[model samples]
Target: SGSTQCDKLTSEKTELTVTPKELTLTTENITATAGTTTTLTATFNDDTLNTGKVVFKVNGKTVKDENGKVIYAKVVNGQVSVEYTLPESMKAGNYTITAVYTSPNSEKLTAEATLTVAKASNN
Candidate 1:
């Protein structure tokens, strides 16, 4: 009598995990003369859970509300950063800068800060 042999097969599956979180923005208080141009910057952190594009705005203007709105807004190493200059002719006052990030899944996050403009000294 001859012996019989048997074999068994098995399959395995793996799933990726991802979490949604808000982006972060940070900057120093802006201080500039009335007639001098000043650069304002905002940094974005993906929080290790969310990754996507971000939008920036100043005083509710649309000029700073898009990816290409500002020349310095470019993504590098999974981070989004933007640098923009304030016009020399802007009036002396306090202004607020706001940034919003929208994830691939339609999740939105916002951050804001204030900028103060000072009058030039005549001395």
Candidate 2:
């Protein structure tokens, strides 16, 4: 039997491209009065692929419940919302309402809307 020797082989380089995921938020301007509850909906681009939590803010401040607990809305099928009740002491004016979203593997996304608070009618 005879032994054979083979030369070294070289391969060409291959290139691959990757794209990052994106998220978008949408919300509508709403009007409400103190002591009244309003539904704030935050819709995302992907209907079935987004998973995260949304935090609602007003006038650059985080929203809190009566017990002073911060509110966090969980993303469900790329949509999440909260029932926000205007505080009785809230002044009647246009407030900037923002919804901030955060996920484990996604960049933070934000949306803003104007909240028009009408003066509570004295009844």
Candidate 3:
């Protein structure tokens, strides 16, 4: 049998930092029907990271509000959200909603969500 030697380990304070470069989007319900409204939220490493604009898109096209106006989400505090109304004429199909967060330097970070549209009600 051999005796083992004991060694002391030292501890040091460590700080970890991360730079956010990715943007993500999420919704409570990904599936929606035509003529219905849904909410989408975009998130990033920092809310203040976006200093320019957060453009929202749908089906590779820009989304509009109930007033038929284009909508853009601005990061307040750390996140941005928007409400979009699906066109009553929208056909039943798979659609993609995207959020493009633009930085002050023109670098764009994009996030997207999916929407499965169903046929409108007969009533």
Candidate 4:
């Protein structure tokens, strides 16, 4: 017995839209007095699950909690924040604040901002 078979192939063109990833860091309190606490916020913009942690740094030094452990803030709805208290003895000047975002499904992103610390009040 002899059998014959025929195959047909079809293709369709598709388009994909790509956008650059972005991360922004800012301070809720742009200026804070020494010995006072301020909030650092990080927001991630990407096409993936935006749940991750943020590592904060000040003046090129990693910020740590009182327990001597690295502080990591949980990201919710693409935003995360942590409180940082300016040292009482810190000089009154501008400081560079940086935030690094880490996630299991996305590449690491970083952002920087400036914070001005004022001299503590003498009240």
- Please write out the lDDT profile of model 1 over residues 1-123, one tens digit for every residue: 744575565778879798855455664467776655555555555434335565566687633523544433443444556545566676788887766656677766666777777876679
Q: Name the 10 consecutive residues with the lowest summed lDDT in model 1.
A: 63-72
**What TM-score fits each model?**
0.58, 0.80, 0.67, 0.74
Determine which window of 10 residues in candidate 3 has minimal summed lDDT: 20-29
Candidate 1 Cα misplacement greater than 4 A, ranges: 1-6, 11-22, 47-53, 64-72, 78-83, 103-107
For TM-score, candidate 2 versus 3, the one ahead is 2
Model 4 Cα lDDT, one tens digit per residue, 3-121:
45756658898998998555554443368888888888876654344577889889899889888799989877777888888778888989888888777676677888888888777
TM-score, cand. 1 vs. native: 0.58
Model 2, range 65-102, lDDT digits (tens) per residue?
77989999999998998988888898899999999998
The model with the greater lDDT, 1 or 3, is: 3
The reply for model 3, stretches above 4 Å from the true place, is 1-29, 47-50, 66-68, 121-123
Q: How much lDDT does each candidate structure score?
A: 0.60, 0.88, 0.73, 0.77
Best of the candidates, lDDT? 2
Candidate that scores best on TM-score: 2
Instruction: Give the residue spans of candidate 2 off by over 4 A.
Output: 1-21
Q: Sort the candidates on lDDT, descending order.
A: 2, 4, 3, 1
On the 0 to 100 scale, the lDDT of residue 118 in model 2 is 98
What ranking emerges by TM-score with the best candidate at the front? 2, 4, 3, 1
